[model samples]
Target: MKSQCKSVVTIIVGAMFLFAGMGFCQEGSEGKGGSAEWTKVIDSKVSEKIGDKGLVNFEEGYIEAVGIGAPPEQFYGKPQARPMALRAAQVDAYRNLLETVQGVQIDSATTVKDFVVESDVINAKVSGLVKGAAVMNKTYLSDGTVEVTVRMPLSGLAKAVIPQAIADDKKTDMKEHKPVPFSKKPAPADEVYTGLVIDARGFQARPAISPKIFDENGAEVYGTLIVKREYAIQQGISGYARDLTSAQSNPRVTDNPITVKAISAEGVGKTDFKISNEDAKNIRAAKQNLTFLQKCRVMIVLD
Candidate 1:
């Protein structure tokens, strides 16, 4: 009877090992399939990010951010996992957007953080700005990853942020200025023109929350608040250019152009003025004479 009992135990142990081996084989096959699926999903998602011709349209005056999310292991197999992942991705996208906007570059060797600390008020404003941003695209990958793209028009964003920043800093008093019609002024000389061009080559000249044009005496001739609200919204910039041809393409351009070289930039945060002593006298003369320059188109050529 003892010998028979040993034989039975041996058979049971052998069967157990056989079953374990079969389980491992099945698991290995499933893992291989899962890895293949993961690769396909990743490839497709990357292609989507690149878009046609592998280029993403980050047009001037528009800020865009992309985010990705995947469900955690604990949430996997749950009915709510897909939706939760998507929501998490959207939140991630907004956080990225905030970081992009808040990460302001101060100079070649420094950034905004070197000059000022971020406060709760600034965080809240950034949150509001993200909430108002427009949704650009959304995608789901077979590997359980969700992706989202969001964008905010700089024109609208500036209208909201600039005034608040100025109010908080109390650095400059923002007043409204009415533009006189170009028809009111007499024709300019051969050298004088209706439109304004600023040559900012050999230096960094970027878009800001509030950008202004100043004369040599430090008087403001053109600024964010000076332009009509509709015009600002439509143009989305005081002006920007890399060269004369590009400057001419600006919506603010005209047949004749008055050119100037930028001397310096000043003010706190993203709100500043680009000063030009070279054309300051001309700008003052134009303003004093109530020339068409008051309503003329302007462009800035940057390096």
Candidate 2:
């Protein structure tokens, strides 16, 4: 009787950590749209990192985790059991979300977990934030398990993790560089360049919380250095996509984005990009670029 009275929430949560420790493989969608056929795919289609613990949807700007639990044998048929099972699932969901956010890449070199581990203050704050994550959905499974989904906004999580004056970082001198045109076009350089889209595909670039862009001469072109902490925390340092069309079409960048090609992926983590001096100059030259870049209006197309 005592064995049957044990609550599944506590037991299931404990058992679930075993899986977290082992870690599951990253789950990604199959059949990406190549440039030739990008229009056919939905504009809303974007990259997602799914794992056994939870998922981070880059397009939708949220991290989600699903927690599962079941009522104990003794309480299975009682009215109080439903709430008990739901509570267990909710607890389990928060735990899963913690693991998911921890895995988020902060830069080419570190992850959110790495940052939090280095500071007990930040660790506590992030934990508290995750606890308050919204309960997006709750469902009673056909097989008896109760599942709950909790969602955490990326913007909110980033605000806490960004830390210090790093968000105020901008160390580039746009005036020093000579203008190198990306192409011969009717649009003048002074025209309204609403945003920037870096076609970084095939360079093996990966997304991060913040990433820097450099010219061939190793001068910084874009990133935290130019973007304000407020905007970076709002829409992230930059958005990412699997196709050029989707990336440019995104409202984040708006219309008429200055498109450029990346020369190579920089940094050991491949989170930063190096563009040709010519393309880099074009990105820096526009008078309107400053306003948009400040708001973090940029996108990267990845393979």
Candidate 3:
């Protein structure tokens, strides 16, 4: 009887050990599975934050940028660290975009003091424009860093800068004028065009609220009032391209295309260009078919 009791006790102890070991193995497997799933989720989030290059959408005039941030000492062990870091990253991204758009070069002869003053003004304008920027993506990394991406639409940039540009133009002595109405003569029987394309390559062209196309004699052939104010506010002054395909990609393509060339550009504070006489005549002739190019689906190729 004693031997049987001892055998029964030994069996019970061995069974308990086996069950405990099984429970531990199951727990370990579940822990590893959960960790693997979390890693995958993080990777997906990072990929989303770093969107594809095609996200730029140049046709729609959208620009994108990325920024990164990490926890700061002031927020050490605090919940606010993440939020603070994120805000910092966003500000950094905006600065980056400002640098990109503020490519306007100051004159070399300008004194350091003058450059500083001008730079301050430029910085203020850029900051105001960037405030309306859109936040596209945000992510938190395993290393306690935060990443962000911001986008600015050219249309939105135009809306913000156009009014200021117009104001600047007003400060100048350059008077706003209207395009000469084409002689109300009958159209040439052979004339056919879809829209205007300016070969502005090899010349410096910049965005303007009231871009003008001038003749060789410095006479304005097209000016601000010619383009609808609503259109400028919506579509911007002009769409730029490096080639015909890029030009057509713009939302402003037309069927009857009239092409021109920019011979030279003037003005340091603003961009003004003169077209060749041949191109000027083409523009004048185009005025006869103004209905097609009314929105100035004009494309200026740049170097």
Candidate 4:
């Protein structure tokens, strides 16, 4: 009877090992074959966050305007309460998204630079990326919308490590191996210099790239400096910019108006004063003066 009992125990232990190995094998198979399903985890998290916050919207990597307009003459610095909320929400969203993505390799990360925010228009930038695969060569994606670049190789330690890291505690093991930080282009701000008192804000431009202007009294202004620099749009074609002088003078001039002016003395690319499409044709049809990239100082109120 004792001998038979020992034999039964041996069989039970063997069965346990067999089941454990099978479970591991299944997990491996799922990781290898379920790329689409695995990536959905990221999408779901992002969507959930957006739904919770009605003022913020995101599709794939593009952030849409969802919040209400800012109060008139509101000061612009780093970001107001709304942008702070968005930033925090975005980070949490991405963190949750990463938790769901198994076997995703982050090769590099950099802050998207050169964002300009004058009044309320936020021209924020995103990061760019390059992906490497075991089979295919490399894939490139623009960081202009998203903040991360991911690489997925068919076979390698990254694949195995991804599953292990996630299953263990939804942790990323590549924190130490992250790539270099990407610098974004400086954006426009809301400060303007009157050569006497620096204004806290001009209008809402791309506040991210806009710098704070200071008077000799050390008072901070929310306008931008008229610095001369090479301005390139995302596409290297049709380098056109509308002026913001007339529009700034009359904040309520039009819902959308195409105005142009050089904000600086050195003669760089002028700010693009964009209006609605309907008004665009009217303005152009009337032979209204449009400011392209190189047009200098038609009108700029420093004070």
Better of 2 and 3 by TM-score: 2
- Write the residue-wise lDDT of candidate 1 on 189-238 in tens digits: 65556577767555444444445665555556665434444444445435
Superposition error at 110 for model 4 (Å) = 12
| Candidate 3 or 2, higher lDDT | 2
C-alpha lDDT (0 to 100) for residue 246 of candidate 2 = 86
Tens digit of lDDT per residue, candidate 3, span 158-248?
5645554544444542554335565455457677665666665565444333466677766565545345556667776666665665665
lDDT of each structure?
0.48, 0.68, 0.50, 0.22
Sorting all predicted structures by TM-score, with the top scorer first, yields: 2, 3, 1, 4
User: In model 2, what lDDT does residue 128 have?
Assistant: 65
- With a 3 Å backbone cut-off (N, CA, C), the pairs that clash in candidate 1 are none
- Per residue, candidate 4 scores C-alpha lDDT tens digits across 34-102 of 123324533332211223211111112212111112212343332353333323333332332222221
> Could you tell me every candidate's TM-score relative to the true structure?
0.57, 0.73, 0.59, 0.15
Best by TM-score: 2
- RMSD of each candidate relative to the true structure: 18.1, 9.8, 20.9, 25.7
Q: What's the CA error at residue 66 for candidate 3, in Å? A: 4.4
Q: Model 1, which residues run further than 4 Å from truth?
A: 1-59, 76-82, 102-129, 139-143, 162-192, 215-217, 224-237, 264-276, 287-296
Clashes (backbone N, CA, C under 3 Å), per candidate, total 0, 2, 7, 46
